[model samples]
Target: MTLARLAELHGVATAYEPSEGVTVQVPDATVVAVLGALDVDATTPEAVAAALGAARRATEDRLLPPTLVRWRDDGPVRPPEDLPPGTRLRVTTEEGEVVEGLDWQPLPLGVHRVEALAPDGRAGGSTLIVAPARVPRPERRVFGLLAQLYSVLSSRSWGMGDLGDLRELASWAGRTHGAGFVQVNPLHAAVPGAPTDPSPYRPSSRRFPDPVHLRIEDIPEYGFLAPEYRDARDAVLADAAELRERVLRKGALIDRDAVWDVKRRALELLQTVELGPGRRAEYRDFLAERGRALEDHATYCALAERHGHHWRSWPEELRDPRSATAVVRADDELTARVDFHCRLAWLTDRQLAAAAEAAREAGMAVGIVHDLAVGVHPDGSDAWARQDAFAAGMSVGAPPDAFNARGQDWGLPPWRPDALAASGYAPYRGLLRELLRHAGALRIDHVMGLFRLWWVPEGREPTEGTYVRYDSEAMLAVLALEAHRASALVIGEDLGTVEPGVRERLARRGVLGTSVLWFERDWSGTGRPLAPEEWRTDCVATATTHDLPSTAARLSGDHVALRHRLGLLTGDLGRERALDAAEVGDWLTYLERLGLLPEGPGDEEAEVRAVHRFLLRTPAAMVGVWLPDAVGDRRPQNLPGTWDQYPNWRLPVAGPEGQPMSLEELAASPRLHRLLSVFGSLAEHRAEPGTGAGAGSAAGSRTAPPDARPV
Candidate 1:
């Protein structure tokens, strides 16, 4: 390839002028070998000359670097003063080969390693170790949340799902369902106010959990509160009871913000009581460790409430995170509020740790797989506290694709690779360690980002975005190192637009991949659904994912109608409907062929169950059943693209009639028991093969009628 083309492929600009005809001094034999690999006819003088010219041009353009240099009889040449570490140099003489100061021996063909040596009498040496790059890891098994902790049982929660519900769900999955793991959306701290953003992905601070998930009765301070405050708590409980009644009797969607408002009021009253010595000490340690970052975050929230949430609209003195004026202002007026937020974070951390403990107590093999969002909100605590870590004028988004012809701008800034490396990846490592502290596994959303991210410059359209490469080796190395230390499994959400070789690399490092039945296809050819046996075992295989419609919605074609209603359908409605119908028909036929679906008219819920049972057919180490789908809940918890036009994240999981089910109701429901029974049977069957009809049947048995088998 030409130098310009190589530079373009590497996403490097080639504009620097060569001062003195940049010399490339690789061994002649090595040059011949590389040229041969490229299929160049080096034996011919003209071809040899052309190859040499191309090599020199490539080096000059910084696309390639020489491996070794030769000298007839000259003494060792001094290295360049400006040469950065990892620059490779070799000296060879015609008389005899004398390689000195070589740091790396038996270096691979294309990989690079850096080494530095002292200048006192000893010579410095560095070598680039090159090897064939590996592929990224495949997806792992991941469970989805049916509802947030405080939001699960509306009647019992101060207005949301609480820790008690989580404990119950964990116990049920561990003992009854025999599930490997349970995953939840980010439980990160939310801004303390009305109309809080419900999307967990866009959190105020990832380091802390939202106190709204706390159950009032469960709080240690609840019993010690003043009688009047206790009565106030009772009133909140009464309000929550009504909300729960609405969900059960009238089918109401969850109100996350309203729940938070109630919880905040109760927590404020409870905060008055002094914590015991042990708890107080723990809180102090947390604050000490968090230090200025926590202070800054809390101060920002306090100032935001006063000056509006947007940082740009804040008072000029408070705009800068480190300004003395801002510090004075915070100390004078926002100290109490800042301390309150910090206290909330400490309590949430305790609860998160408790939840993980609950999972262990429940006999879960892997407890609490926490999800790390791709990025935080642009105006959130992370962005404010760690501004230098982010790219100044760029946004992270997707390039033009079939799903989004206009491309997508996620409206979140990305980390500058250069800055991250310079800081020794402290921020990344810290975040990982904190999340993994209470998690059995950590799911990294947008795993492809570790390799490279599409950087959309400010004011530029997504189509105009350019791919900014990151040091994938370093990134993966850090991840593996952290996972190894934590003894926690790593699951990379390697879903859309993956670059080649990323999966293989991740798998090699023992990280797991994600596989959704809907998207698992023979992309190479034949357009066939990927066989269960052919699926990678080191992955989380599931029937559906959070981003996609539930199996019920897909089978009933409710998703199609919903999209059309939202005016999100780009193609003609008739054409889209025909395609959708054909896809659903194909799935039904495939299921019937495998004896998974009955020939008779099947209910959407039953079909959905069968589809999950089909997923269990795969040899995947982990299988996630979306919690909502377990009880035949049709509405998705989230719908992308439209924000206010649709209730994106507020919907509570509902029954067939759209009435919400409380945690207690869900736990006791026969419907849920039936679904858990499927998982229980699968686990039992997996323990001893050929015992159950589901375990005995092959996934591809076309002639076996669904009624003839139990799988």
Candidate 2:
């Protein structure tokens, strides 16, 4: 392929200009492969001449430049042995000495600063940093939520669990259940509109929280509304009450958009009043600290509301985030709305911090463990605000695997690896610091992306996606440095088609891997579930995940039937049903063999408790109870790739009869007490073993099966 075609395929903008006379490094193998794939006969004399001419023209035109490409662990430290005549070698070590030598001794580990001065003294150099071998850290604790955050019900929640409900749940878990940490869904900011997207994984912005999570009554300014606005507020309250009643009494799925609509109307009124002096100052400081990024985000939201969510559909000027005309237009027309959105972000941040404080007050050891989604919406504030940092024409996705033969496009642009490195990974580090500010631990979705991601070119199927490598060493180094600074634990979602040695690398960095009970099998052998002793100690073990079915659903084969009914099953019904049955039967038989399952036809709740007890036996450091499992809510929160056809992320925590249970009622229920009692017994057993295991260890072991060994 021509250099122009190769650059286009890689999503490089046409306007890019290489530095003058720079010799860019192109992998010879890659170039030859590209040429062969394009059917260019490079071996022929005429073809060879044409190819050479094209290469020279491309290089001279600066369409392609010889850039140094370095891969982590490519080779041992060595100076360039084959420099051109009069080549000036300048080596700078960690000691900050610039020495001239063609052959220098290996620099000590850690970031060894190096600079190479070109022969002309018109220097072009880059840092040559050494990295320590990535090593796994000791596993930390992880406690699971029963359901999606907004889907959890409390008597006071407007038909769904809000931050208030989470605070209460965390308090109860820490004080009564002895949980070290509480893990919940992504809770990332969602696009604002009717019938809002329920899947938290596909969020508008991973950097911000969705205001929909805020409990209307919990706002400090809620009660201070004008009398004229009081009636509207009361109406909204009544609507919330009705919504809650629908879930609690009628067994209706929670409507996130409806809930948000009620809250948004009320919030608009609440915004009429300015923040109190202290809060206002804090808000100002936040804006000042965030600077132009905050302004751009706010402006994007404002423009989106006016011109539809997609920035591409906006007026020509507004389409470009950096356009001076767009800035002036937004300032003149949407200033108030932009400020309002900014205030919402500030309020959400305050509440998040408050929730952490509440956890600390409630005696929680790790406090809140927040989730980071894999990517942001392509048309959302984050994409518009940080357009320069992301790949414009490529989408992030997964390659075709056994499970998803067609692969999948996430429709979220990924950070350009080169751009991120050039920026010193500032955006990534900033996002992490914000999330970790109030988090005891952070769960990174699709942690494998730190190494490489499937980049699907525009207008191409997922099968055409290619792997774009990243600097995992630099990424993990930044992660470790930040985690150390924040004193927070890290859990990487390392399930599904992980590249070889990735988990081992993450483990070495003190980052925990995710192990779901169903998928944690010895794939190299008979594919049987991993024995507790065989389970990795540096990991979080769970029965299921948001993408999968609940324990009860999986065991009963309801998930299979649901998929079949929805026409999502690719295989014959009999085969799918049989596979599901056999998997569950194997687990049940294993549990019985381990003496964890009670004899006879056990109730679903009893079965779930048995599963937890089984998990408590595993050597894995962290165990997560899919929050829904706690209450026997046997539905998956999300089914991959389905939109509008299924009730994704709408189900509330319900009893067997499908009646939603409020947090107050759930907390007070005998069933809840029984569940907590089982957890308490497990905790007591671990403590008595003199393993120095506390809530953290027990929680970490929640991922293990019964009879599983201790980490």
Q: Against the true structure, what is every candidate's RMSD?
A: 12.0, 8.1
Candidate 1 lDDT by residue in tens digits, 547-613: 6777778888888888899998888988988998887777777877888766333677667767876
> What's the TM-score of each model vs. the native?
0.77, 0.81
**What stretches of model 2 exceed 4 Å from their correct place?**
1-119, 124-146, 324-333, 598-603, 681-711
Candidate 1 regions with alpha-carbon error over 4 angstroms: 1-117, 120-151, 191-194, 246-248, 324-333, 598-601, 685-711
> Candidate 1: lDDT over CA atoms?
0.62
Q: State in Å the error of residue 390, model 1.
A: 0.6
The total number of steric clashes, by the backbone 3 Å criterion, in model 2 comes to 28
